[model samples]
Target: MKKGFILIEMAIVVAILGILLSISYINFTRLSVKSNVDSKADEIASMLRDTYENGNKEMNFKDYYIEIIKNGNSFEVSLISHKNSVRKTDLKDFELNIVGQTFESSPKYIYFSPNGEVFLSNEKIEEGYDYNIDDKKFSDIVIKKGEKISKKIHIDDMPLGNITVD
Candidate 1:
């Protein structure tokens, strides 16, 4: 019955605190990763929507091309009227499923028409292909940070694409 904690009691208290801190740190790391992945997914989905809207609304640009490059974990957008930009993200290894087709190494393209439609393609879009796309189509863009964390963005088959994140 001492007035202060003995050596063994102090050691036990320190051990318990260390364990709790370790657990909290691990959980915090996991949550941070999840947050990063989710935000990256949302950014990609929003980029697609913005590209479509900009293409349709801007009268000067004949067409806007959004080319996805998985190697760089980035996408570049270009317009016929010389407007071009690129977006780079921290996430990588995106699994893009378009019309049941998987795009891995090769690049993919989603071009918007001033006519108010969006189309996906494997090759670089050409002038002739602008108006050749049929009715709207559905596509999925899966953004992944690693093996464990991921988010799915669905682009529905509607004019200008109806995008949803899950």
Candidate 2:
């Protein structure tokens, strides 16, 4: 017959709500980190694909290369256009990092042939040099010739690892 809950009931309700909110906040943070990682990977892949497609056009017969450089916990991906001094510029450059993720390989320099083939400067995709984002043990990230650019996330828990490029 009570019109309002007693103090004990109100406290219990507040506690339950707090617990639910904490859980939701944790999940949200985890998803946010995963989303950020996925977004960065997708951006890199897109840039690579664009470079490959544009190189295939043979516009002015210029050479295009995607340069991956690692400095400390961060890495950068840049599109280098080899042509006239004025025309030579970085099409896209990005510096990103995920707390504890490490790159199990060294810096990679991928060249895009005018014929749309993707390969390293050595003309071959080097093994044991794939990027390991989030330390999920993911491998084989070389962009193969005539293959679509794609990446997958391997996050299974919260607090993703920092990135390290060898």
Candidate 3:
């Protein structure tokens, strides 16, 4: 046997390195995509939670709610008070699945009261009760970043609703 490696051996080594590199690249891509999806979901959840928790502290009488709507290629999450936007966040590269029925071209909404109640409609907020609160009217907001990756933001549609993400 010669001291140096043959041409076939060199070719095999290069091919193996290329294969490994490709695999690593693919894995990195998948991880990056997953990270993006998770990051967006967390951002959304935080926005909703912050608004729900602190919104009524300043103006207890003002109705506070979150508006989530599809805006072209991105989604818009706006915290609304007295029919005006308090804060807005725009997210890209995802889809928002509103489990509850939207009100006639209006955005999906989660209204909050000073008493910690959550409602899908703000129309009946001042009436002191939701029009329908049968314990099964929970509205789900699902954010999906592809066919395989997704996150759910469950907003309990009841007297005292909690915002949670996963």
Could you give candidate 3's per-residue lDDT for residues 1-166 as a string of tens digits?
A: 6699999999999999999999999999988888887777777677667667665566443366677776676788887776778778777877776566543444566665556555555242453543354432445668888798888877664534467787
Rank order by lDDT, top first?
3, 1, 2
User: Where does candidate 3 stray beyond 4 Å?
Assistant: 58-63, 81-87, 102-106, 121-137, 156-161
Give each model a TM-score. 0.73, 0.55, 0.72
Q: How would you order the candidates by TM-score, starting with the best?
A: 1, 3, 2
Better of 1 and 2 by lDDT: 1
Model 2 agreement with the true structure over 24-92: per-residue lDDT tens digits: 998897676555555656555555555555666664223555566666545666665653121212212
* Candidate models: Cα lDDT each: 0.63, 0.45, 0.67
Better of 1 and 2 by TM-score: 1
Q: Pick the candidate with the highest lDDT.
A: 3
Error of 3 at 27 (Å): 1.6
lDDT, model 2: 0.45
| Top candidate (TM-score) | 1
lDDT by residue (13-120, candidate 1, tens digit) is 999999999999999998988987788778777777777666666642234556666656544323322335655443444444455555664566676655655566
Q: TM-score of the candidate numbered 1?
A: 0.73
